[model samples]
Target: MTFRARLVGAALAGTLAAGASALAGASAASAQAEPCVQRIAVVNNAAFVMSFSVQASNGLETANTDTYPINQSRTIDLTTTALPVSADVRPVVDAVAGATRTPSSFVSYCENGQTATYSVTGTTYDYSVTLIG
Candidate 1:
């Protein structure tokens, strides 16, 4: 090949290589930014039925169980690109009952595909959270 033609060919190859490298880098970043899927299972073992919402708002939308029954579990689906995400399990408490107890929430954090189980045991005033990776 002519010298000038060889130089032009080399330049074109370098440009293509650079473009491919940049595309690969962008793909890796997009994979890292993919939303992490998490599951939250809330079991109501208490005697009375209740309502609640499970959320953290750390880049994920809030999920709720509007009317949870006794001895049953409701799973909430959440997604976020952020790591070390937190779950705020807030149960609805009757304000007219006695002193209007604030909702006893169980706050916990989980990773990608991890499951957090919150059990409402004892009474409507208490709860517990267990994280499973």
Candidate 2:
């Protein structure tokens, strides 16, 4: 091939290689860009009253909790947001709860500004969370 043509070909190959690298880097970034998550666990195993369970907000929008009942149901507000499970929040909570829970009935809601509400009926408890768009 002519020298000028070869140079152009090399330039095009280099451009393509650079584009691929950039794309790969973006993919890696996206893979690592998942929302930071936090969790808390509450274990209720006695017939006596339990202390108030408090939730900590760190900019995450989702929350999960599991409860084991001893003698009563435990009501937990996972979030401190004032908007407590509005219409927009309902579907998200319902979808997550439906997919996560078994034949059990659980209550979840969004409070606002990175807070949620969760309750468990059992004596054991497991909790999880993630930030949603």
Candidate 3:
């Protein structure tokens, strides 16, 4: 089922730790620190199928092998196979295989239990990743 994105999540204490911890804004000393263990909604509104993959500062990568159809949204569970860091959802496959799109969301944007929505819109030649909550 497609998970709905909400407006909750992410808190950093003091200075962020190094590496992936910094991206996640998590530190052992920070009492409000929380991992980004939540559902992510990938909404594809483009003209062709879209493939996505996630990369974290902690050297963790999850490649979504399935192609998402246009006008469809896929709910991905990051609670188990991922960390708390802000991640990059790269559009790896589409009509334009060599085109580039940079759209990212901070870990602090959504709470642990909340969902984050990353929508891809437009055609392959002029695609953009919508940074929505």
Candidate 4:
């Protein structure tokens, strides 16, 4: 081969190798950018059966809402491409005999692991809610 041809071939090979390396690096970075998963548990410590809804917002237009029964604990799994900074829990009070209570509401922020637990307390006349990591 001519010397000029050899030089051109070498330049093309080097360019191709550099491009492949860059693509491989980008793929690795994308693999490392896994979506985050958040776990939330709700427990009811009240006498009457409680119903509650959980909602998670993560900048995206989509929001997750689900209602679950209390007394028995419920675990909610929230998966999002971006981390969820906040969540809201709203309770619905059921009519109980001789009971006058208001539903409790809670707002919680994400922790390092994005795990939280909320509990419903108080009697039929009054309801209290708390959230903790």
Candidate 4, clashing residue pairs? none
Top-TM-score structure, candidate number: 3
Q: Which is the winner by TM-score between candidate 1 and candidate 3?
A: 3
lDDT of 2 by residue, 1-133 (tens): 9999999999999999999999999885554312222222333333323333332222223344333344433333434334333212221212222223222212233333333223323222332222222
State which candidate has the highest lDDT. Answer: 3
Task: Please write out the lDDT profile of model 4 over residues 39-129, one tens digit for every residue.
Answer: 5566777665655444433223233334334466665554442435544333233324424333343344344455556676776567665
- Poorest 10 consecutive residues by lDDT, candidate 2: 87-96
Stretches of model 3 off by over 4 angstroms after superposition: 1-37, 82-100, 108-111
Order of candidates by lDDT, top first?
Answer: 3, 4, 1, 2
For model 1, how does the per-residue alpha-carbon lDDT over 1-133 read when each residue is reduced to its tens digit?
Answer: 9999999999999999999999999885554322233666667666666655554434343533566567777766555323245444332332112221223343444456755555555544444333322
Candidate 3 local lDDT, 1-133, one digit each (tens): 2232222211232233345666655454343312243666668888877777555544566656477678888765665555454453332334445355656443331335776677788787788776576
In model 3, what are the clashing residue pairs, if there are any?
8-111, 9-110, 9-111, 36-84
TM-score of each: 0.43, 0.32, 0.56, 0.40
Give model 4 RMSD, 1 decimal: 10.4
Against the unseen true structure, what C-alpha lDDT does each candidate score? 0.51, 0.36, 0.56, 0.51
Segments of candidate 4 deviating more than 4 angstroms: 1-37, 56-71, 80-114
Please give the TM-score that candidate 3 achieves against the real structure: 0.56
Comparing 1 and 2 on lDDT, the stronger one: 1
